[model samples]
Target: MTSTLDDALKRLEMAVGLLEASVSRRLEAENRRGDLETELQLMQDDRARLAVELDSALTRLHRFEAATDDVSRRVRQAIGAVQSVLVQAGQLEPEEG
Candidate 1:
């Protein structure tokens, strides 16, 4: 009877130890999950910010390209006017394609 009681107590202790180890593992997993979630949120926020910055850069680039095109057109028109005046003054011969 005494041996049976000791065996039962030992089994109970082993069971408690196993339970504690399982709970510890679960708590550690939960903590790691929380950390990963926070990091993922930060990454998502950074991605959004980068997307906005990229869009702004593209918009500015488009405006600059449009301005460059306008300048080029105006320069071409001025050159054509100068060529016409020179031709009328007999200072330059007419160009042939």
Candidate 2:
């Protein structure tokens, strides 16, 4: 939907084309005709899979960081509250003569 996506698609297409050409040229040396279409399809599938995995990983990382920050904040607040209570209770306790 965005220009960035369009750019990425273009780059991927170019890379696929380059890969197909390279494989074909290399196979020609061995008297073999490689299936460029199949290779391209495989590459595309791999790219898609990696993209999905990356997105999932990034989402999880963000959630983990947010949860960590939330817990840290709560812990700091709890510690301060406990410290205050301890100080008050210490003052209230009668001292030995």
TM-score of each: 0.87, 0.57
Q: Count the backbone clashes (under 3 Å) in each candidate.
A: 0, 0
Residue runs of model 2 more than 4 Å from their true location after superposition: 1-34, 91-97
Per residue, candidate 1 scores C-alpha lDDT tens digits across 1-97 of 9999999999999999999999999999999999999999999999999999999999999999999999999999999999999999999999996
lDDT of 2 at 31: 57
Model 2, span 1-97: residue lDDT tens = 6899999999999999999999998878655334666688899999999999999999999999999999999999997778778768884443355
lDDT of each: 0.99, 0.87
TM-score of 1: 0.87
